[model samples]
Target: MTKATLQRRPLVKQILANADDNLLVIGGLGSSNWDITEAGDRPLNMPMWGGMGAPVGMGLGLALAQPSRRVLVITGDGDMLMSLGSLATVATQQPDNLAICVLDNEKFGETGNQATHTSPRNNGPTDSGAGTDLAMVARGCGIADTGTVREASQVAQLVKDLRAAKGPIFRLVKVMVEKLEFVMPPQDGAHLKDRFRQALLGHP
Candidate 1:
């Protein structure tokens, strides 16, 4: 089936609009970081600036530590692909409060838009073979609540699943490739950590 065209900013805004104080969001570096900040800068949101594949692992740890809070990891496809094995580990641990959403533009947006494994390739030198199906990989790793979101119509359900699905859930959201201006959050790592810690734990 052909994928629907969706913009990352609106989709992210819609998802976060429904979120509450109990939602602990961990954003992957680069575009994912900007997207979440664009949605809204909250004390509960932790946007990583350097860690490439750390969001999922960090979200898992946070979820395990705070079982009552819903942990959402927002990352790019390239970042998620780098830590593919972490999916298996997440499945093994089966943290019910954790969910992962990959904003898959199918290219390495941060590094000169290089085609990632998730990018579709034809028979040519540039081909990296067929595009990787991340939702399938997540399901194969025992995440039963997994899906790909390519339509605006799917956004509502995606938000609902992120909030209430039996996790560790995974979703691959196909977003458009656009050069939007960066919407940055506070870049101070220590400050971000202190703010998020204070919001979630009531103390920095």
Candidate 2:
């Protein structure tokens, strides 16, 4: 499977296995396909058009609330960069069961494919735009168990490693933004909110 397939492929099973786990799917609505499909039915998903950041903070709250259960956060490159400071908070709290999966596509694919701080650069550091390495940032935030994966096949192993870790683990999985841009059109009130509320309370 390719990187995109890998990022999405095993989520359902994992989510089901850890049903009791508090899942908070945050950041980049269109970046991760698994998150979108799984989120429609996922109780803990926090959908955002280009919110880009905020999942980690929410995940931290959930993790602190119920430390025993896992807090899985599905976020993106743009999301984390915008809220890199949240990592400092997460590292300080050091929630053992928390796992942050960053679907790193380099650019802000959801918004006209503009470059984010994480995108690699051909120019020098001074000339570089959005010069941030997620792995480095995670480590800099004082998270020692952070790692990045560029291959699709390594996803399961990476997840396993992160799960077994005594962390606050950050898994930055690099993906190619070949899917183009897809902006989510605004919807009417009550429909999305009601579904989200139902999901948040874990009701059918």
Candidate 3:
């Protein structure tokens, strides 16, 4: 976590720059929801308001439902940790169009910048002295296409994999913890869902 240099906002923007009708994005709760909104709040982008660990699951379902389209789940480390088991389900399903990109700031951003499990711990009397590796977890859960992006230089390849890669891709992007403005989407969940349905389908 200490060695991370990439900023989340720009990285997120890069990921969604080429988003077309064929792409469906699920932004995880908290900072990622705002990050995706800042990138561009399109109908194809479903930014969660309160669901902490449901983005990946939603992405999986969407990918299954729309096999021809690409489904990307952009989530935070905190949210990912809450439902690491979902990775196993995704791997089991093996959706070719589903990709998960975890924005690991190593902190629980919404609940005050508290250290998440992904944050490195010191060998102190009260600490475990170990940090969880999410990419390893994904690999262990049967996902072959998994990687961690710590430096800005590696983002280009990561973006390629995210946008145009094969089935069940998992990536962890280590981002810096900084206070950024919240660029919110529509506050109403039903309204957002209905709009998304109307856009993706011909009716809501």
Candidate 4:
């Protein structure tokens, strides 16, 4: 996204500015980019653990935990597909203020471009992505509203609209490829964790 656009738009900035202690990011392996990782005031990237598709569930839990605040999820297409069933749960609960931002690169950057359901060009089974319409999936899951965005400039505004939302909305940002790859040292766990904590303070 940052790559194709040539600039870091307001993906996390808008959310953080509007955040009233109610937003958490669940980034997939591909989400380790500094733009998304360090952007949120309360930024959160799910650990490189299995069940990559579970971030929505975690976001849902937070929304359910504190209904008064808004909750946003910055996840990838591959991560969201692992537990697609959870979307039904999200729809079933229909928690207001739960907005999910899916950066649909069509490939899983985390696992060396593992094909996600939303992949536009699937080479084979292993490289084949879901090839499904994620926006439609979100609609089927009972999202309040959904759209596919191409330009990076729309990111901030899209998130702002979601923040003001009264129901669960989803935005599918169609990015060509990852603009940048984050290179973290092997064992910076403790230090990086603290850095992430500080990143959260930048949010509203």
* TM-score against native, each model: 0.95, 0.74, 0.96, 0.72
Worst 10 residues of 2 by lDDT: 180-189
Q: What is the lDDT of residue 200 in candidate 4?
A: 52
The models' CA-based lDDT, in order, is 0.91, 0.65, 0.93, 0.64
Off by over 4 Å in 3: 123-128
Best by TM-score: 3
By lDDT, is 2 or 4 better?
Answer: 2
- Window of ten residues with lowest summed lDDT in model 1: 121-130
37-147 per-residue lDDT for model 2 (tens digits)? 443444445455444566788778877876766667777787788888999999999998788888776777656788777765668657754457788888998999888
Q: Which candidate ranks first by lDDT, i.e. highest?
A: 3
Which digits, one per residue and each the tens of the lDDT, describe model 1 over residues 131-201? 88999999998888899999888889999998878799999999988899999999999999999999998
> Residue 99, candidate 4: how far off, in angstroms?
0.6
Each prediction's RMSD to truth: 1.7, 4.5, 1.4, 5.6
Q: Model 1 — TM-score against the truth?
A: 0.95
Per-residue CA lDDT of model 4 for 130-165, tens digit only, reads 468788888987775888777756766776666777
Q: Rank order by TM-score, top first? A: 3, 1, 2, 4
Clash pairs (backbone) in predicted model 1? none
Give the lDDT of residue 65 in candidate 1.
100
